[model samples]
Target: MFNDMMHILTTQSGDILTALREHILLSLMAIVIATVIALPLAIALMNHRRAGEWVLQVAGVIQTIPSLAILGALIPLVGIGTVPAVIALVLYAIMPIFQNAYAGLTGIDPILLEAADAFGLSKRFKLFRVQLPLALPMIMSGLRIAMVMIIGTATLAALIGGGGLGTFIMLGIQTNNNAELLIGAILSAALALAFSWGIRLLSKLSVRRIGVLLVSAVVIIGGFAGYRAINQPAGTITIAGKLGGEPEILINMYKDLIQADNPKMDVQLKPNFGGTTFIFKALQGGQVDVYPEFTGTVLQSLVKVKGSISHDKQTAYKQAKTLIKQQHNLDLLEPMKYENTYGLAVRQADAKRYHLQTTSDLLRQSAQMTAGFDPDFYKLSDGYPGLKKAYGLNFKNIVQMESSLRYEALANKQIDVTDAYTTDPQLKQDHLVTLADDKHFFPPYQGAPLVNDKTLQKYPGIAKSLNKLSGKITNQDMIEMNYQVTVQHKKAAQVARTYLVKRGLIQ
Candidate 1:
């Protein structure tokens, strides 16, 4: 455990550093922007005593909205990426800075103002020399609070494809990989602590010079760092996806291939293990270069269209290829022969007791039992609601659990029936029986490589290598691979290499 922690800490230091820098830069930018606008607004409101309460009230209201909701709500209008994240942070940071600046300026000792007036100091001179200096400490306190808040909130930015430590945490939770979870959590906490300390140190060193040299230096240094990080050459190909049993193993395979083919190529694998929607958003925002996606998911969720094709491998693969290209300007590489379809799964004992041979039989008995499903499935069109409405099946209870945990729920009889993807290794490992979807409610989910168009174009050889494996892998093969990692304790790279060598894809 000690070694594991050290390994995680060492591997993640760069990412931790980067996340901290970005968080600090963003917070500083937001605070600076807010200070400029809010300070002046506060001054104007103070002059109009009647409107002062109204202005502060409005700012307070804006502050009450949760930061994540604000960021999510802005995605449609502003689109995904840093802009929305920054905007949300800025809005959240405003109230504190505004209120503090107002209090500091207005709460100044009346005798001090009188003394300046008695000395015949000009109004502008009194405002600048006396009022602004006295207000600096209070304004800085507001900034300090805003900075810390922004750092904590910035973790959610990864949901929209903005890169940060949150990326790893989401992945870890999805896959049930404690190692990844610890890495993300520890690193993120360290980053936040570092930023907090740095800011406090800066406050002490420059409390007296708040208006001039120190502030200018901060702006210049921060701008340079932000520019460098954003423009860093993206030599690495990052593969990210939702954490299902097999996908994580599959990604490791792809990463090994890329690395073996070109030692210079930096290949990074990020398994979301979260949900399909999270992984999809990450890909769309260019947070990852590639990931494994099902043909059915791409057709329904991504393309937002019903697939008219048959559930056969060929039909699904062809449609997926065309749809991905047209909709996302992405390339759906040759698909693996495997199909990971969604079906109703129950323990063998329950299946026998109910005489449930297919989905039709399960539907008849479902009303008396509890059902388990992945959380995101509740919101999807082809998920639980659609399943119930279409099949006329109603369960006594509906429980949402992670994909990794659902099998356990079924085994323990916590849920008599739960949704199972056809290719999940757990189906075979746990000896769970699946009832056929006779009504064809679920579309064929053929396994395929979903690649960024730019990546495909740049590395033409990648297409060739990936295509060779297409229509070759089966659901059984994927399950076995997943078992190798989760149960047998083999790394993804090793499993992938062994398979590739057996197929003559590599020496």
Candidate 2:
């Protein structure tokens, strides 16, 4: 693990530093924006107690929505990237700052104000010279809270391509690289602490102190803008992928193929895009040009196809392609040979002991056992609910968790049954057996490239470049490549390069 950390630091030092700077800029901007709005609003509402309470209540309600949900919701209105991410952070930061500012101003002793008035001070003079100084500590406390919240929440900006430490964390989860995850998490906590400490230093504010802070903020903003202006690159094609080794490898494969054939085309990969839905959203929103997707996912989730299994596999794939093109203006390229559908898995011991060979067999024992599934499975039509109704399955307990953690949870015997991808490498390593879907509950999930029509029109060679791998990868081939990463701890790029070279797809 130590060696892994060193390797990452050495190879990705520039990326790490860039992400840290972006994180700081994003969080600080949100807190500063929120403070600017909240401080003035709090001051105006100081005498209007009833109105203050109402405003705070409304801000509180906005804060109740999950941060990711708020960010996702803002995509359509403001579009993706830093603007929406900063907006979400600012919304979350408002409540704490506003509430604290109101409390501090209202709680000030009336005698102090009376004394200021007796001294023949103007209203502005009293606010700046007397009231604000006394309320400085409480206002700073609010600022501290807002700053800390912004720093933590800003990590999610990477999901919308805002770019931050969260990029490393998401990629780490997708690739199962502990060093990357730890680096992102540790840096985020450190940033929060540093920001909190900086805010704490302003417990007693003076005119000069405020002036110095304002100047510093201006300098930082100017520097950030200059950096952004100088860093813009051209001819970049953005590629995104869902969470998992397969997607990671596929995205890397696309990058290599595109650049190898068309040297002028530069590929920028955005892997571990949280989920299939988010990836699709990014493509449709023009945040990403292309990504790997499963035909079954497009048909079932996006097209909302019912009774998908009734149609032949080719028919389902063709219908999905046509509908996606007509509705979303997205094209589904020729699919690979492999089909990675969901499967119910159990430990080899449990399978042998219960003589479970099919979904029906597993159902017979489900009443006495617990099952764990990925969160997406809960929403799928042919997933848990459909299976339960089909076979009358009622597990003793049902746990919904991340797909990556399911295999480990099953191995530890924490769950008697869990959802597994047909091509998951851990299945072979842990000697887990997949129950046959005798009832044919799932649709075919052949792998393919889902590209935006605009991207194809802009770069006509993209489709031709991507279709080289069509019908190339078989089920066993995908399983072996996944094993090379998850079990052997090989890098996804290395695995992808080796396969493409061996198959003579790339030089």
Candidate 3:
């Protein structure tokens, strides 16, 4: 494991460093904003006991909300990227800083305050010289706690394209890559501890020195942000993907393909940018120019077209393309020659014991089975709900769980069946077999390039370049690539570029 980790870090040093930098800037920015909002408010509320209590209660409630839930909720209103992520981090941060500041100020002796008053000091002068300085220890403690919390929580920012160590963590989880996961987790913990220790040292310094240090810190962070803005490529195209190894592989392929054909066209990839909703919102809000999407997802998730799609994948692709073009003004290029639809997976042992080979075969044992499904699968109209309706399956027990955990439970015999993407690498890893969808309850989920209409209009060659992938990728090809990334712990870009070069799609 150590050797594997060292190799990964050596080969992917640039990305790991970039992720660390993003994580640091994002966490620092949140802590700075939180301190700005919280410290003053904490002092102001100190004199108003009732208002302070109420405000603390509100902040506590906000802290109770799950970070993921907060991130998901903020997507529509604020869109993806640093804005929502920073906002969420700040929300989580406020309570600790505010509470500590209030406690510190209030805990100061009334005798000390009286001494300052007797000295004929102005309120502002008393605050700066006496009250604030005395309260500095507690305030620093609060800031330290907030900083540590935000640094850890900042990983979730990657889920919504906020760009942080969380990107590596999420990708690692999706691919079952332990080295990648450990690198993200260990680095986040290290960052938090370092920040807390630094804050402790700062608290020991005099107020004047602390002020000078803080000013210097602000300038450094600001300069970093400014440098990034100045150095970024002008008119660069952003290609994004949803959370999963396959999307990561596909997006890299998209990048390699476009750049191979149009060498000078600057393209940036945001692989595993987020889930369906988050990435789609970014696309709709014009944050991303293009991404690989599924025709069935276009119909079921985006277009709100209810009912079953056509039996034939080609016809389904046309239907989805037409509806999406007319309704959303987005263009979907030709689909790859593959169907990565949903399927019900079972343990290899169960398949033989129960004689289960298809959806119809499952009916014989439905009443005796306990099924676990991904939450999205359970909720989708054409997912578990539709599957139940189609096959008249009456599972003995049905439960909703995360997609990854469901597979584990199924393997452990805690669940008799679980929902799985047809091309998921875990299907091979666990030696599980998918029960054939003889009824074809789910729609054909054919992968295709979805481009923003305005972007395509501006860069007309983008459509041509992306469409080169149409009808080219086979199921076996995607499955192999996914296996390489997830099982072999190979880089997605390396696997994608290799495939493209092998097929003469790129040099």
Candidate 4:
């Protein structure tokens, strides 16, 4: 596990750094913008006295909108990426800063203001000398709280292609990989803690020398902006895709390959890992260039085909190619050997007790069993809802869970059965029994790269290199690679390189 952590740290160090930096910048920008707007509004509201309750109520209403929902709503008007994420976070951080600033300014003794007025001090002079100076500590406290909240909320930015620590967690959940999830969670928490401590220290120092501290803050903020401008490259490439499973892994694999081949390319991989429908819309709207997709997913989810096609690999590939080209103006590249098919996984002991050797056997006893599935299954047409109808198997209960939690759920006897991918290494490692699908309702899930037609025309080499990787990686290979990251603790890039060398794709 230590080795795996180190591997991930080394390989994804760039992405981790980028995520942390972007998150910090976004949070700080939000708080700063909120402060600029809120402080004056707060002062005005407090002075009017009659408007105090209304202002507080208005700020309270803004706070009530859920962060994720606000971000999602902003995507359409502002579109996906960093801008919307920043705007959403700024709006979310406003109330805390506004409320505290208002209370701090109002709570001051009226005698101080009267003295300033008696001394013939202008309104601006009184605000700068008396109101702001006295309220600095309380305002700083609010800023601190707002900063912390923004840091935590920034993790969700990955959903809209903002690219942060949330990508790892989302991918981990999709592929039922725990190591990535833990790493993502830990790194985010550590970053937040570090920022919190730094802010607290600043708050303390501010009390002693306010002038110096304010100048230092401005310099620090300016320094960060300069660093980002220097680091940011000229060109950009946006990659988008649906949430869950092996798709993200494949995208990262391709990204590494591209960068290794041509280091000068400023390839920015933007992951739009959300619901399948969400990603599909992004692709159609030209929000992304390439994403890993399965033939079966396109057939069942996109095309909305009811029944199944032949398991013949060539047949499936041809159908997928035709469908993508005709319907979406997209290209389905060479298919990989790995097939992430849905299957019923049961604990070894349970399977043995029930003599469940196949789906038919499991179906016979389905009424007495309970099952767990990834949350998406509840929504997808070809998911559990469709599977039950097609097979006529009814479980005693159905539990919606994150994919990573499904194995534990089954082992702990929380559920008797689980919907799992055929290539999951845990099925072999944990000695879980997988029942064969005899009904053939599930289509061929051969992995392939889907690209916008324009990208293929522009980067012809990309297609060539990716095709070279096709059929080279099998189901066993995928399981082992996934295990390396999730169980054995190896970095995804290292595993990919090792596999490529072993397969003679790269030297």
The candidate maximizing lDDT is: 3
Give all candidate RMSDs, comma-separated: 5.4, 4.2, 3.5, 4.6
Model 4 lDDT, full chain set = 0.75
Clash-forming residue pairs, model 2: none
Return the TM-score for each candidate structure: 0.72, 0.83, 0.87, 0.78
Better by lDDT, candidate 4 or 3: 3
Show where candidate 3 strays beyond 4 Å. 1-14, 41-66, 69-79, 122-125, 175-179, 346-381, 384-402, 405-418, 431-435
> In terms of TM-score, which candidate is strongest?
3
> Number of clashing residue pairs in every model?
2, 0, 0, 1
Q: Give a tens-digit lDDT track for model 4, residues 315-432.
A: 8788888888888898889988888888888999988898988887888888988888888876687777777787888888887988778888888888999988887878867778
lDDT of 2 at 482: 88
Give the TM-score (vs. native) of candidate 4: 0.78
lDDT of 1 by residue, 1-507 (tens): 566556655755665576556555665666666666777787777567668778888878988887666765675566555567777877877788778878888889999989999999997888778887787777767777777777667777766555566766665565565676687777667766776676666556443465574468557856875896798667767787565447766787677667667778877766533456656665666666788888888877788556365566677677878877988888888777877888888888888888988888976787799988888876687777777787888788898888878888888878888888776666777778888877877778877888888887788777776667777877678778877765454556677778888877777
Candidate 1 weakest lDDT stretch, 10 residues = 205-214
CA shift at 323, candidate 4, in angstroms? Answer: 5.3
List where candidate 4 sits over 4 angstroms from the true fold: 1-25, 44-58, 73-82, 161-223, 226-231, 235-245, 256-266, 270-287, 299-329, 347-357, 361-389, 392-403, 409-416
Error of 4 at 496 (Å): 1.6
C-alpha displacement of 348 in model 2, angstroms?
A: 5.8
